[model samples]
Target: MAVLAIDIGGTKCAVALTDASGDILTSEVAPTPSGGDAETLWRALWSLIETTVGAEPVDGVGVGCGGPMTWPDGVVAPLNMPGWRDGFPVVARLRERFPGVPVRIHNDAIALAAAEHWKGAGQGVDDMIGMVVSTGVGGGLILGGRLINGGTGNAGHIGHIVVDPAGPPCGCGGNGCLEAVARGPALAAWAVEQGWVPGTPAAGPVNPELSEREAAALYRENARATGRQLATDAAAGDQIAVAAMNRAGWALGLAIASATHLCDVDLVTIGGGLSQSGPLLFEPLEETLRTHARMGFSSRVRVVPAALGQEAGLIGAAALIVGGDRYWSP
Candidate 1:
């Protein structure tokens, strides 16, 4: 069966057409209309969907969107997407557009977990956690060979797990949350505050002669100091950048240790822009995890980078329909 998959995030929105095995047949991506109102953003996304799907009939539609949403209902108010902070009825609109086909929506992080378990890093593992440490930190859990949707459908939300009692304030109106310290922008900001200068940007506007892809790359490079730049600097041996990575890694390990103890999960698959930092991040994370996760069961847990890379979100979204009740319920 053909399924329509949508992945919505602050930086970009992607749509894909996939078969039963979650292999994408066709896909499209565009920068998110983050500065626009909800209606404008939705219209843009719908246009992308229409263009990608064309006249092909999909059997079901599934969406993975950033969270703090009312799930099953799919009323989203993703913290990073300011335009949708008031909440958008994504599932209702998808149902309206697709009619008889089943429509499913879940936290993007949860979708990532489902994707990993279905076809990626956690494929053979019955209990694991999938985490994204990019624009923000988020996670989803699988246990006993099935996805776990807690009371509010927000169960494996590890981003808000506190790693330090006296750390920075978080966007969730709490202090010392893991997201507050480890999210890309937050980590970069922390690095800047500690006197680390990010990569220098070209002085002029993106050259009109450049290809669309090149121009987009230039624009992003010029926009702000982000976790990507921090990683670059760390690789170049910048002390403050190294320190920032260590801090983020340490925080991630602490939170993971807590999650291991709580859920008894044995594997963690991490993805997203920041995870690209390679060993600079994972080494400290491993060291810290070993320090705190000393219990017999938790000690065996392993953390690894996600195997599906950028397509994981879309694949996971498709799994909501393709995998049937194994990854989706209500």
Candidate 2:
């Protein structure tokens, strides 16, 4: 029997079947429908789940969804997802759909963290922060070899950490949040405001000749095109793009430094579209972190790109069941 894993994000949703060891056996991905109602979104995800699972029996089901949700129960209202702003009873819906199996849901970022800790970059590390810096910035905390759920299951959400009190307003209605400053879309928007022209590729409409899977992949790439273009331009000596990347990196470092001090974490694994900017981002982050994280215990902290890449969320979702003792309690 395999565990069913679901990863839901603002840009895409994925479903996978994985064995007890967390190795994916089969998977499917779809671009999350835009301008849809809550039910519409759920229907799309449900379609994927049903198609992926087919007649396969599963021992458990795990989900990683964009957060600001009521954990354990999984009533989510992801900040980036307007359709779900009114909240969706994800866990209840899944339980009804899959009856009899253990169903679990958690913040998508936390799921990625669990994956990194279980088999990726943070594999042997006992304390770490796993973060995603794409459409949004979110994270999960692992301390003393186990995941921390905090009081509201929102622990380790570093996206809203204030990096600049006077910076741009965030979707969360706060000013200068790390998410507002460093997330891919936010960073690209900032660069545009600063006169940096993003040379995003003309992905246009999905080619009619392409397979369904290829079309979905293209749609996902188009969603993050501007940010990816920014990285490319920065690499080619575009000063404005470089400045934008540096700005994002600095904010990330500042927030990570504060997190390191509070959590006493020794490692941070950063994933998502922006982290792909390579040294253009990490170099500035390292500089800012070193400057601010001067406390003796925080000085040795290491921040590196996540090793599991795009599959981190799926793997982590699987961990909620396979590695339940450490990553899941409710």
Candidate 3:
């Protein structure tokens, strides 16, 4: 049987119709509505679902959404998508469109976490954290063989965890959060403020102020300091690029260390565009973990890059429809 999945984001929505094994049969993409994100997003999703399910029977529907969500209950308050404050009637809307089909919805990060456990980097691990450090930072946690869905369904809002009490302000109205310090656009903005980057992208409610590709490229080009280098095949020997990566890694490690102490979760699967820096970030993270995490259990946590790339969100969303709570464990 084929399952149709839709991943909803502030800017874009991806639709995929796949089989029981999670093999894609049909796919579509649409821009999210700016002024009326919920309505526009739902409309796009409906269109995509209709197109994919046409002539082809589907087993179920899964929805992967952004954070500040009320899962199973079907509501979300994704800060990035400002037009939506209360919640989106995803379940009701999906039911209206495809009556009897079972539909499950979860935060995108949670869905991606499920995918990681099922088929991606966290394949064998019973306990793990899947994180997306993109234009924004989001995370999902699996504990004791079940998806950890809290009261608000935002159990794993790792980005908002205050890493630095004195750091820059975050959209969530906090200071020095991991999201403020290391999210894609935030990092790029930091770079631009320091004269590392020349231009700033528009900061609309829909778009952030950084470029993943551009930031990665810069990491390779301006390997000027011990803590700032563009990761590149050419700059493999450059000390600056190495340093920048180490700084990023250190930040990641520090946060993970804190999480390890709190949750006792030792395995973290890092995904998203920023993690593509790979060793540049991971190496420092390893070092930081060794220096920081005081508890023996915290030190033993294994931090690995996510095996699945962009496909993680879409695939994990589909897995949410069937896996129930067996996705990840701690």
**What TM-score fits each model?**
0.91, 0.89, 0.82
Q: Order of all candidates by lDDT, from best down to worst?
A: 1, 2, 3
- Write model 2 residue lDDT over 1-330, tens digit each, in one string: 699999998889999999999999999999999988999999999999999999999899989998789988999998778899999999999899879989998999999999999999998999999998887898999999999998888888899999999998988888999998888878788888887755422222347787766765665555443778778778867688889899998999999999999999999999988888789999999999999999899999999999997788899999998996799975
- Model 3 — TM-score against the truth? 0.82
Model 3: per-residue Cα lDDT at residue 320: 74
Give the residue spans of candidate 3 off by over 4 A. 33-38, 82-86, 198-244, 327-330
Q: What is the lDDT of residue 45 in candidate 2?
A: 93
Q: Per-residue lDDT tens digits of candidate 1, residues 179-210?
A: 99999999999999998767532222346788
In model 3, how large is the Cα lDDT of residue 163? 76
Off by over 4 Å in 2: 200-225
lDDT of model 2 at position 123 = 89
Better of 1 and 2 by TM-score: 1
- Which is the winner by lDDT between candidate 1 and candidate 3? 1
Task: Name the 10 consecutive residues with the lowest summed lDDT in model 3.
Answer: 198-207
- Candidate 3 has an lDDT of 0.72
List the lowest-lDDT window of 10 residues for candidate 1: 197-206
Clashing pairs in 2: none
The 10-residue segment with the lowest total lDDT in model 2: 197-206
lDDT tens per residue, model 3, 235-327: 353343344456557677778888888888858998877777776677778888778887777777888888986667779878876665474
